[model samples]
Target: MSIFSKIKQTLHLMKDIDLDALGKLSQKVDLSEIMKTVGELDDRQLAGLMKMLKHKGGKKGQHKLPPIDGDFYDMALKLSPQQRELQIKVRNFMEDEIKPIANEYWNKAEFPFQIIPKMAELNICGLTYKGYGTPDENYVMEGIIAMELARVDVSISTFFGVHSGLAMGSIYICGSEEQKQEWLPKMAKMELIGAFGLTEPEVGSAVAGGLGTTCRQEGDEWVLNGQKKWIGNATFADVTIIWARDEASDQVKGFLVRKGNPGFVAEKIENKMALRTVQNALITMTDCRVPESDRLQKCDSFKDTAKVLRMTRAGVAWQAVGCARGAYEAALKYTKKREQFGKPIASYQLVQNHLVEMVANLTAMQTLCFRLSELQDEGLLTDEHASLAKVFCSMRTRDVVSQAREVMGGNGILLQYDVARFVADAEAIYSYEGTKEINTLIVGRAITGYSAFV
Candidate 1:
C-alpha cells in the first residue's frame, strides 16, 4: 500500500474510538497534533488507537516510581513555591556539583575553593540578614537552605555557616553601622569570608562566662592575646571575630582581627576525624592589635555574642536534619538496588524497618526544624528554643547515620557509597556549634530558671 493510503486507512480505523478516551490518553503521550488528528479516525483505527493507548498507559504505569526522598513529612513542600524552588535549586547544585566531588575533597581533608563562585551565584549568603547585599530572606528559608546544603555535605554547610551566619551575624547585630557597611556587603558577596574565634583552647562551653582570651585597651588599639581552637574557616578567612574578656571592663567584647595582622597566626588543626573538609584552625593572638573602630560597638558583654550563637544554633539543627536525610536517602537507594538472597534487600522486613526508623527520625527532625524556624521568624526564638532543637536533632542524626551505615554493611564505610561522608560530618556538627552537653545545659537553664552551663 502507498504511504498516504496507509495513513488514510489508519485514520479511518480510529473514527469509532471515543475521541474523549483518546484525548485523555493523548495527555499521556508526547505526540504532536494528536488531538487535532483524533477527529479523522474510523472504527478499526480507533481499535488500534485504543490498543496503543493501553500499551502506552501500561508502560507508563510500569515506569512510574516513587520519589527517592527521605523527607517523610514533605517538609520541602511546606515552603512557599519560591522557597521550594530555591530548595530544589540548592539540592541540584549539591547533587550535581558537590556530590560527585564531596568524597574526594573530604578524603583529602580540603575545601573545594572553586565551588565558592558557583555558590555565590545562588545568592544565599547571610541569607536572613537585611541589607548588605544579603537575600534578607525569612528564618524558615534560611533554615531550609542550611538543611539543603548540609544534606549533601555537612562540612561545606559548616564552613558556610561559620562564615555567613556566625561571623557575619555578629557584625550585623553588634557592630556599628560603619562596621556593618564596611564588612557585611563584602562578606555577603563571598568576597571576604569571615570566622568566629570564640572558643579558647582552655574554654569550650565555659567561655561564655569566663573566657580565657583577654583584650586590653591601650590608646586607640585593643591588644588581644589568647588561643582559639577549632575555629572553622579561620585559616583562610579574611576577618576573624575574636571575642575576648576586656581586662579593663571585665566584659566580653568582639574585635574584628584582620588577616595578616602582626602577631596573629592560625595553624591548621590536623588529624580531625569529623568535618575534615573544613579547615579548622588553632589561632594564637599574641598582642594582636585591632583598631578601636574595628570593635563591635553594641557588643558590651557575652550576652551579645550569645545572640549570634542563638541564631546560628538553629541553623545547626537544620544541618543535623540534612545530615540525617543524606544518610537515610543513601541507605534507601542502596537497599532498593542491592540484592540479598536473589531479591532486592529493600523488600526484606529488617531492612524496611531500618528505613522506617530512619524516615521516622528524619520526619521528626524536619518538623522540629520547621517549628524552630517559625519561632525564629516570629522573633520569639530563645537560646533554649534553638538549643532544644540542636540537641535533639544532632543526637537523632547520629543515630540515623549509624543505622544507615549499619544497613549497608561493609559498603557503608566506603566513601563512594556517600553514607560514610555523612557519618563523619555528623560528628563535627554534633561538637562544633555547641556540644550536646552544652546545648542541653542551655535548655536546662531555661526550664529551671537557673544557669547550669558553668
Candidate 2:
C-alpha cells in the first residue's frame, strides 16, 4: 500500500483507543516510543497494535451494573393493592421524614417524640391484630412495615418493634377481651405509648424459661419486684408490660406496669455503641402494685411469652434485611460516583464482587423473611422457624454491612456517609431477639431432635 494510505489507516485505529487508559499504560511503559516503533512496522504489526488498543479500552463499551435494587427478586409484586399502598406509605414516610434526622437523633441518643403522632397517622400500629381499631392485615404486611422503618433507621424500627410488636402484641396475644378493648384502641391511635419489659440484667435468652422478677397475688393487686434491663421504650412508655415469674405457680406472667408508679423506676441505659436512639432502660420494680385487672390473664405460663417471641423474632429478621439493604444501597450509590484510577471504582472487579455478594445475601435474607411472614400469616409458624430466620438473616447482615464499610473506605465509618450507622446497628440486631448461639440451638433442636441447651 502507499505510505499516505498506511498513515490514514493508523489514525482511524487510534480513534478507538481510550486515551485515559492509554495514559495509564504510558506511565508503566513507553507508549510514545512504542507508537514511534509501531510506525516503522509492516501491516502485520499494525494489525496487532489495533487489536491491543481495542482490548485495553474495555472492549469498546462501558460496563453497566444492574439497577441497585435491594428487592432483587421483586417481592413487592406479590402484595395486594392495599398492602402495596401500605408499603408505599411507610416507605415514603421513612425516606422523607426519618432519613433526614436519623443520624442526628442517633448521635445524641434521644428519641424524637414528635414523630409518634406522625407515625400514628399511618394507622399501622398493632398491624396484625384483628380487633379494637387495629388494621388486622397479616404478618407479611407487618414485616414490610418493620423493613421500611429500618431502611432509614434501625433505632426507630426497634422503638416501633417494642411498642407495636412486643407491648401491644403482648396485649393482643395474651390479654383478655377487656384488656384488649381498653388498651389496643388507644395504643393504635398512638395517644398512649407502650413498652415491653422482659429482658433483664440476669436473663435475656432464657427469659422465656426463667425470669428473675417475681410476681405474687396479694389481695386485689400483684406485687412485682425485680430488675429488668435493655427494656426499650420503658423510660417514657405510658404502660410497660413487665413479665415476672408468678411465685405461687412458678410460671411467667405479664403485668401492665403504668408510668409514674411509685415503685417502678426505668433508668435509661447510656453510652450505647449501637441503636443509640432507642431509649433502652434498666427497670427496677420495688413493691410495684398492679391491679388484678392489669394482669395479662392469658399469660399463665412462659409458654404464652414464647408466643410473643415467636411473633416478634420474625420482625427482627425483617429489620436485619432492612439494615443490610440500606448499607448496600448507600455503598452502591457511593461507588458509582467515587472515582479511582481515572474511573468509577464500581467498574473494578473486586468492587463488583463485594457488591454482588452483598446483593446475593440481601436477596436471600429478603426472601427468607418473606416466607417467614407467610408461615406466620398461615398459622404454621413455629419457634424454630422464627429462630432459624433470626439466626441466618442477622448473621448475613453483619457480613453485608462489613463489606459495605470496606467498599466505602474511610468514609464508611463516618455517619455522614449513611452506611456507618448500619454497621453499628447491625451488631445490636445480631445480639438481640436471641443471640447467634441461642437461635442456632433452637433450630438445631428442631432439625436434629436433640436439645443442645443445658
Candidate 3:
C-alpha cells in the first residue's frame, strides 16, 4: 500500500536475480536519488515497474503443460479411498520400476526375473480373490490394477495376468479346497510363479470344443500327454495348470503340473515381435503323471474353463485400455515437444485431431471397463458382457495406437520412441484373450439368441 512497502514487495519478488545486480548497479547509479524519483510515480506506474522486475527474474510467462493423464474421465475419482490409493501405488510402481527396463527386456525378448521380489512387496497379486493370502479387493480395483500395469508395459501386464488372473483364477475357481490352500497362498505371495496351459499348438479358440491334449487315469495317477503353445511364464514358472480332455469322460480337466518333472518340458518361444518381454513357452508333456488329488476337483468340463476365461477376458479389456492410454499419453507429450514449420505439431489442427480421437477412444475404454468390472463384481457378468468389452476395447486400442504412431511419423516405428512398441503390443492384445471376430460372435449370440460361431 505504501511506497516503501510496494518497493520492498517488488524487491522481494526479484530477490533471486536483482539483489546482487542492484548492489553492483548502485556503485554506478545514484541509488538514493533514483529511489526518490521512483517514489513519485502513481500506482499504475509502480505496477508496471513490478512487472518489469518480475520478467528480469525468469521467463515465467511460458505456458505450462498439463500432467500426462489419459484418464480424461477422472475414473479414479469414482474409486473408494483405499482402492484409489492402491491404484496410485500400482501406477507408481509401473512407472518407476517397469518403464525403465521395458524396452531393454523387450528388445532381448526376455522377462525380468529380478522384478519378482520387488513386485511381491506390492502385495497386490490375486487382488480380487478372497482368503488364501489375497487382497479380496473388488473387480473394479483389479481392472484398475490391470490398466495401471499395462499403462507402462503390456508384456508385464500379460505376465501378471497369466499368473494372477488366468493361472491363479483357474485354481481358485476349479481346484479343490486343498489345492487352493496349497498353491494360491504361495502364488499370491510371488513365492511360486504360475502359468496357464490351455492353448495348444493345434487348439486355441476351439479349445472348449476339445483340447488336443489327452489325460487318462492310470491307477492313482493320471497320464497327461500334450503340448501347449503361447504359455506365458511357462519357462520359469514353478507350476503350470494344464488343461486336457479326459480320454474316458471326454470332459476337460485341469492338472497342476509342477516344473522339473521328467515328463514336462517347456522351451521358450523365440523371435517374437509382440509381447517379447513375456516368456511364452511351448510346453510338452509326455507321460506326465500326476496324482488324482492334484487334478482340479471342480473342473469337470470345459464350462469351468470358460468361467476362468470369461473373468480374465474383462481384465484383457482393461489391458487394452492401458495400452491405448500409454500410447495416447506418449504421443501427446511427443507432439507437444515436437515442432514442425515454426510451431509445435500439437498446435496444428490435424495433429490435435489425431490426439482427440485417441483420447476419445481411451476415455470410452476406461468407462466401459469400469462398468464391465461392476457387472463382474455384482455377479451379473455373462460371457457376452466380457466378450463385448474385449471386442470393442481391443479394436479401439488398435486404432488408437495406429493414430499414435501416425502422429509421431517415422519415430513412431522405433522402439526408443515407445509408440512403436505399443503398436506391436496392441496386435497381441487384439488377438489374445479371444480375437475380435470370436468376441463379436459372442455378443451376437447373446442379442440374436443364436450362436454364430458354433
TM-score, per-candidate, Cα-based: 0.87, 0.85, 0.87
lDDT of 3 by residue, 1-454 (tens): 5667555555444545757877899899998887776667666686677556544423478775655679776676566546666777788899899999999999999889889998998898899999999999999999999998998999999999999999999999998999999999999999999999999898888987888899999999999998999999999999899999999999999989888877999999998989999999999899999989889999989999999999899999999999999999999999999989998999999999999999999999999999999999999999999999999999999999999999999999999988899999999999998888888998998999998887
* Candidate 3 global TM-score: 0.87
- For model 1, residues 291-325, the per-residue Cα lDDT tens digits are 99999999998989988998999999999999999
lDDT, each prediction? 0.87, 0.89, 0.89
Error of 1 at 12 (Å): 39
Q: Which of 1 and 3 is the better model by lDDT?
A: 3
Candidate 2, number of clashes: 0
Question: Model 1 Cα displacement at 263 (Å)?
Answer: 0.8
Ranked by lDDT, the better of candidates 1 and 2 is: 2
Model 3 whole-model lDDT (C-alpha atoms): 0.89
Candidate 2 per-residue lDDT, tens place, 1-454, comes to: 4444445455554755668977889789986676566667776666666445434424447664455568877687567546766787898899888999999999999999989989999999999988899988899999999998988899999999999999998999999999999999999999999999888998988887789999999999999999999999999999999999989999899998888988999999999999999999999999999999999989888888888888899999999999999999999999999999999999999999999999999999999999999999999999899999999999999999999999999999999988999999999999998999999999999999999997
Q: Which residue runs of candidate 3 sit more than 4 Å off their true CA positions? A: 1-59
**lDDT score for residue 319 of model 1:** 95
- For all the candidates, what are their Cα RMSDs to the real structure? 9.8, 14.7, 10.5
